[model samples]
Target: MLTFTNMRRVARRAVLFCLGGMILTACSGKHEGAARYRTNCGICHHGGEGMKGEIPPLIGRIDLIAATAEGRHYLADVLLNGLNGPLDIRGVHYNFSMPSFRNRLSDHEIASILTYLAARGDSARPPVFTAEEIAALRAHPLPPSAVADERRRLDGIHRLP
Candidate 1:
């Protein structure tokens, strides 16, 4: 019953099955945002947790940020224009300049990244960024300092965490 041909057949089937699964996942495009996030944002964000003292976390906070219309616009603006100067996140001061991806990433890619971050939060309804929304933000560019100012304004109204 345990013949060499039978063993070979089983091994081949296993290999084919593994390959099929990999191919299906690749084609699904479900991980497109994840792949982009890993390559672009993971360095600073570090699994969306951010650095303890340096960078601000995105996981538990982004959804809250994207909840409002102004907040959604702010998120898009941040991606397009970046943010510079001091920030008081959850009462901790962080002074770091986030580089703009305006020239580097496409609108779709930026939307994917934002959508990915928004979805990672525990919000009942996470905001989904679209290429059109990103394009709208792209049309009217703001300075990094201005984006920081917007963040401050938003913090005043929302009590950002």
Candidate 2:
């Protein structure tokens, strides 16, 4: 027969084992999400000549966006609903709008993409956009009129090739 002390020890070990398993599962999920971001968003957002003034560079911009609350909000909204019109980042203007991925990606996937971008991009401070924030952006939606206005504004600055 086991003593009370031994029973407590066994229970403690079981708890620890369960916690370890949970941690490993969470880590695996993150790894998979990172891979998905590379396969999807990395195609256009990662690196390259960037369509010659169309798509913005993802790297290094993360810090820039984190510097201001409005910038952070805009970044989250753009990722959730896609951006339309002219976007001026680091002095260069991207005249084309990005398509929304709401139908294709889950909230967690979107959060992972944002997390990757925030970590790897060119911002001075990386900003993480929460899944809740993304869901909220999706709920509100960007107005078509606003998108059209941005498109026209961008057209005035540069022609998309």
TM-score of each: 0.81, 0.64
Residue range 1-161, candidate 1, lDDT tens digits: 88999999999999999999999864444377788889988999989988866998889888888989999899999989999999878777789799999998999899888888888899988888889989988999999999999988998897876
Candidate 2: C-alpha RMSD to true structure equals 6.0
Show how many residue pairs clash in every candidate, following the order shown: 0, 11
Report the CA-based lDDT of candidate 2 relative to the real structure: 0.65
Per-residue CA lDDT of model 2 for 18-89, tens digit only, reads 999999986776676578777777778654235548677766655455455555555656666676666665
**Candidate 1: misplaced stretches above 4 Å?**
1-30
Name the top lDDT candidate.
1
In terms of TM-score, which candidate is strongest?
1
The lowest-lDDT stretch of 10 consecutive residues in candidate 1 is 25-34
TM-score of 1: 0.81
Off-target runs (Cα >4 Å) in candidate 2 are 1-26, 47-52, 122-125, 144-161
